[model samples]
Target: MPTRTASCTCGQLSIEVQGAPTGVGLCHCLACQQRTGSVFAALAGFAAPYQVTGSATEYVRTGDQGAKFIFRFCPVCGTNLFHTEDGITGRVSVAVGAFADPGFPAPQVSVYDCRRHPWVQLPPGAVAFKKDPP
Candidate 1:
């Protein structure tokens, strides 16, 4: 597997994913939009038993299902680094845009579609689920 390196836009924070992503998905919830300022947020989840260099700010939040999701990021660039959900993959979801690799595969599924804006058309080829994966 090809290890990948990524950092905050200002390069203040950096991380190395020793292998391929654990998965990828699109989240259309309001929180995701409020965080990314995009129509939706897509992240490349990776199970990297790695270290994070530089200080990061964190926001501990609970999802609709009450799963604790930790939002971690760089304080300098204000980039959203990763998110972790309880009892799922022990890995974090890394923003694909942060990766040096531009050929990042798009989301595999569309989550929180119930909250997706009607103005934005769903991206082709993604399984549109009303809620998160089961």
Candidate 2:
């Protein structure tokens, strides 16, 4: 795994992922939509021990499990960079659009599908979940 550098649209915030992603996913939940102001959020969960540089504004929220999750973003550019939860085990799910190069890999699974807009269709055979996939 090579060290990869990622940044916000303006390069105000940067992150280094020292290894590959755990899994790539899509979230169709209302929270994600409202948070990102998008139809869906494309993300990649990566390994821990990453070196993050620059300033990030964080907002903490209690999730469905009553666990705290930190959502980090660049205040200047308003790009939601990553989200981390303890349950994810020291990993951060980086917004795919923020990746310097997300490349050929697309999301493996889609979560919060029940909240998905009716017009937003999933690829054939892609798993769709009403809530959390598991």
Q: Estimated TM-score per prediction?
A: 0.88, 0.88
* Residue pairs whose backbone atoms clash in candidate 1: none
Q: Which residue pairs show collisions in model 2?
A: none
Off by over 4 Å in 1: 86-89, 119-123
Report the lDDT tens digits of candidate 2 across residue range 36-123. Answer: 8999988888888887888999998786657788898888998788879856677887888887573736777899888889898776
By TM-score, how accurate is candidate 2? 0.88
Scored against the true structure, residue 42 in model 1 reaches a CA lDDT of 80
Q: Model 1 — TM-score against the truth?
A: 0.88
- Which ten contiguous residues of candidate 1 have the minimum total lDDT? 81-90
Compute the lDDT for candidate 2: 0.82
